[model samples]
Target chain A: MKKISILALACMLAACAHYSLAPEGAHTVQGMSFVSTTDWNKSSLRSGAKSEVWTKDGERLNQLTFIGGIKDGQTIFTSRSKELPMPEFRANMLPNELMELVVTSLKNSSGGELVIDATNLRPQRLQGSIGFRFDMSYYDSNGLARRADCIMVKKDDRLNLIIFSAAGMHYYPKEAAEVDSIFSSLQL
Target chain B: MRLLLSLLLLFASLASVAEGAQRFEPTLPPGYAPDKSTDEGGLWYQVERFEEQLQTSPHIIRNTALTEYLEELVCQLAGDYCGSIRVYLVKNPHFNASMYPNGMMHVHTGLLLRVANADELGAVLGHELAHYLRSHSIDQWRNAKKSLGIAAFIDIGLAALHEDLHGLARDVATVGLMRYNREQESEADAYGVQIIATHGYDPAASVSLWKYIEAERGADKSKDTSSIFFATHPKVENRIARLKQHIKRYGKNPKTDETDLDEFQNLVVAEYEGLMDEQIALQEYEQTAEMIDRHAAIGYPDSLIKFYRAELHRQRKKFGDERAAIDLYRKAATFERTAARSHRELGYLYIKHGLNDAAKDAFESYLEITPNADDREMINFYLETLR
Candidate 1:
């Protein structure tokens, strides 16, 4: 799978990715921007310009996905992979329904059944806008436990989402402070 | 020595019973416990651990009355082995009912929702019980080990060597053995029909049960069966054919008297809305609509069924769905036994179509019913807009 990550990097680069390099500084991605506490690798992996990935050790252990400016009828998962059906994200979807879409995406992308551990839904401020926040723990199909923190809001019939997910054993707690800081620095 | 002799005799007796024949009494002889020193015993111990986890798992449905109802049904079907069997109702939306070596069965809510009547459910319960009666799990474990052509103890010793690795290996094995072979499944089917028939349930219901599954699978195009190793799967087509043959051959007029629709509804109607919610979460709109219609046709609460029908229309949002959704939501909201969310949703649909007076009344009713709803602010905003 690590070999797949290397191949993925080459694939993204050859696919006309928009790359931003910074030594632990602020970054503007699509219509949303955030400051990173650590030097992060940002690339258009799924959808060019509309979606981006930031990771420390690639997506194997820890990663942050930025799914921004998705139109009213667009789906959150932009994977062109035809392996599994994609879950859609509609503008009129309730907060809980949108979260269900996220979990469905996680399961479909991973190609495995998932067991949710905890779900904490709270009203949180996102890019100076009132959005919903979700802190969740779940086990992936590979029996790898993970934690995800996400904030999502809909504006002008478009979805702006930022998700931070990492291995629950050590990586999640280790990088939690940085993720929190980055979330705080978000602007739309 | 006595236990071994008894096991041998029991297996020989079970093997002697022919398919589509009556008078096959399923009796569990004394001394069925495996020695802890054996590899099969190790499997049993692992299964016990799984049972323990299942007992406290959040996915377990703990509704006491429902649990008691299922227990009684299993007891009726199990007969001699009734005391040995245990059933767990899980909240999963897949059509499955699994039995472990330790006589622990996990029946999914999907199975309940799919089965049209008690007799259909009885057929499933009886099939799972038959697996336990015939000791298929132990046989499967032995077969798997043989198929791998590895010494069972070598893997057992490795499992004993590392506790964590053993846990992981157990999980993998559990997933691998989720389904039984075609022969075993066929035998279980035959045995289940006989058992339910003996217990006064219509044996013909088994045919209808598989028909439902076949129809559901036929409608689902996304499920890729190309790579599936269904070598031993009684392939739904063959099973339906064999089941019909068995029903004819058994020839005892396979009692068709009791449908038990009322009892089935009384036990399951309260759970339809919640199970439908799980189905909708997967965003399979067509499948969800089919399920709602099936239940509604068979007389589930009109209020809940209409609400879900409205939700199906609203979420799918086809050209005419929004208008249809408004009508259904309004119908659901007017029902006496409605879900509180129905009125709230009706209010939103009303506001969407710029019907302020109707929207205001719906919002007020929703707030009156659910004062502490989480989306209170959003509902209030709609109400203010309507004002």
Candidate 2:
């Protein structure tokens, strides 16, 4: 009986472990397809059904987040309390407004401890749709300087966003080219 | 002459009673430092390490003039302890000011934005200074250590040693451990009023500050009072009442007391736009609207306030917000001192409303005002399309 219970517990633990190593290949997630140039680990921890996270090292070192098909009136980030202000997506939002939403959401996520500066707002094309791109650099609460490259597009009254963030000292420059390739290969 | 002397004696007696009733006094001597072997010393060492990290934080406002202005004001309030205190103006959009036991003080931009004038600012600084002088943080740390036990206390020390003392660990070491009880808060409040009154500032300004905070909190539909400042400090209404009592007991000439409004405005103008930008990004529309209204009521320039009002409407985008934003933008653009970006925003609104000619004209005005605008290329693209 003890052996049987131990075996059941092992299976339960395995079921709870949802993180998996994602191979370098083309894959579709939430109606968006992208080709990964390198192997990365996928995390089950996500904000909602439309959001997913990937990491090479831990999230603090390097992270890639895909927030896809977010409908209007839905928040880009989930906060701990409903009372806390989080910017909601609106279909008619301009490029700058969209950028503000993302920036504000990131600040709210960090409880105002993250000091971020966003600059170089320009237009780009993603998945054959007109979108906007920007650069963001911030210091985490630990005083680690980090940088992110973000691209966002709106399609069929829904928003799609991709962000690749890493420590600015070494990881960002090291992964820039491969991340740019991956961003270029995205299809929504 | 006899009547005047009697009045002075009466005032002195009342002041003595007020001070005696508080039943607390400053424990730290001038140029005070803790013995390195004690628990207080350990806490100060950890905080000093955090201070080193804070110095390099990008969020710190490095403007020499602005920082010097704040430092001078703090010095005026701190008196003999001025040499020991160091002030860091952090660019956060939350109304908070924290004093570390190690004499590192953080004055958030939000607090600056909220206070009407120098007197209100002085009141807050005096309160924080009182906490430092009373050694409230060390007392609270001892209480926390006793409650949390040796195991958790060791964990805190280990976290500090590993330099992993950030986020939750940092909060535990600093804000969490320094949380004061109600009696301590009342004592601080009493001293804050008395100190400001002594410095020729109106003791009533403290009451006004708390009242404004209460009104701002009420403006939010959810009435979220879970902010770190609100959580750690006494309730706004309770603090206001206690402050009123202190003022009644201590104020020599409350009505005649003057606040340096012009000096405060002049010093803050350089950072006003950046402050507004950070506040607007928070997206707490109701509270921000209330703050802007209160700020305008305090006699800030109409042009700047109008632009932020327009920005609030433009970003929230509720029913009728577009029309409100357009009206405000037009009004703001009429003022010569308004930010040139007002025209850019008006141009975007015109484009949204399908008024291409107006959009073209607005964009041209933007270029005329700010020829070297960073987004000049983007504006030129819009103009080309309109043509």
Candidate 3:
């Protein structure tokens, strides 16, 4: 049961368009540019026009997601069905509301199995715009405990965000410093 | 002789009509084990592996006392089949209790939060047990296999069995494969009522549970029916009417029947706040508001209800909501149990409104109440900034 059939794996692969190598140093993706101190593999399965994801080992191990220039009424994640109640971004949202939006969006995206605990909300600057930062800890689908650091800013009535998540037991502590450095180098 | 045999068959058919169809009996024997060569056995193998994963899942509430309570309650309802069942109380904020063919049962926290009494909880659990006893999931699986061929069936099974797959994929596969037919649902509903009434629980509790759910569903502006339980089950109004009919047939003795509200509340109080937090996180304001009010009507502490009400207001942040939240939080802070969290929220609101002195006071009160709070450093930073 642990091993998914090759056909099922192929079906999953078909859903993804492709992957590209995100080499070390400065790179522009979507609407923002950032400098990566290390090489990473980027998924071509963008959720929207302004969102992209990069991974070091695999998506389950560690992932860095960039969502940029999401307009008001646009959801943080792309939902397939109109019935799904994905939270929309609003320009007038307060700092705490933004955190809630992310939490709700993630919960909905995961189909409510994930138990997320978000804490340590504080203000930070992201590419010269005042933004908020928070930490979240939750278990993934495979019951692996994971942690994420998220930073979001509102610029020109649109939302910009970066989230780096990794397994709490090992990968998070191993890659946290590099992730922080990369986040620091983000320019919008 | 042939004429006599035909008359006897006709009489049997007439008797069945008089009884309004034969009642569904449990097909599963106690401690039943299917042979490995059979398709049912293959399904069991898949489920047993999923159970292994579930055992390690973070979502499983590990509270020994709560788990024991639920197990005992299920044992009471299950009777001879008790030994075959294993109950898992999952920390999910959705109203659901699901039963697997292999006798693994999951009771979600949201259901616990919503149920008014142990009898209501028993009603829901009994319904799930009825499904298990009737082997509804297996029947549905076999039906799907007959219609779709073996290859497609295995694909559906593997999609549900794969741990690496996203929840949406798994849910779609599971819902499509395990959805019981209308007749099976009615059978289970009838059995659920019969079992609870036999156990001396108020059969009307089943009707009450459905009515509450129907109202809660109506309260939601978005009418989001994404919950697996809501999606896979029959319509709530229909369920309510049918349950009422069953209750009427089963009869009720109000003075003698047990609700066990006190015991249910006592056992679940420890997990209440966390459960409410998860519910609030769904961001379904009107529905959550209705739930909070219903919980209040059940006699949960006013302070706790007020705090959650304030939290809903704070999170929703509609026009003039912050003021309403401030008022509620201020009221809640008068109670010792909720004082610390209320102060913390008040601090955040005060800071947001640029009332620096009030923010400092509220934060200090929060720190004093919860000296070792996890966010102490962050609170201290805010205090320094205010100075």
Model 2 vs. true fold: TM: 0.87
Q: TM-score rank, highest first?
A: 3, 2, 1
Instruction: List lDDT for all candidates, in order.
Output: 0.71, 0.80, 0.81
| Model 2 chain B weakest lDDT span, ten residues long | B161-170
lDDT of 2 at B187: 78
Q: How does the DockQ of candidate 3 come out?
A: 0.40
Q: Which RMSD values do the candidates have, in order?
A: 8.0, 6.9, 5.4
Local error of candidate 2 at B270, Å? 1.6
TM-score of each: 0.75, 0.87, 0.87
Each candidate: fraction of true contacts kept? 0.00, 0.20, 0.36
> Residue B139 in candidate 2 has what lDDT?
90
Candidate number achieving the greatest DockQ relative to the actual structure: 3
lDDT of 1 by residue, A9-70 (tens): 87864564555655698787657777887887665465334787877765758888888998
Residue-level lDDT tens digits of model 3 in B1-387: 999999998995575344333455789899988898999999899888878877777878875776888899899999999999999887777777777889988788889878888888989999989999989888988888888888987876677677542352346346466677776777788888888888888889888888888888889757657655676677888778767767777688464533455777767676678888888877778888888888898888888899999999988878998999999999999999899999999998998788999999999999999988866766777898799
lDDT of 2 by residue, B252-333 (tens): 5444534355778767766788888888877788989999999798878899889999999999889999899999999999
- Candidate 1 per-residue lDDT over residues B132-176, each given as its tens digit: 888877787777766655665446534432333213323433444
TM-score of chain A of each: 0.80, 0.86, 0.87
Query: lDDT (0-100) at residue B290 of candidate 1?
Result: 74
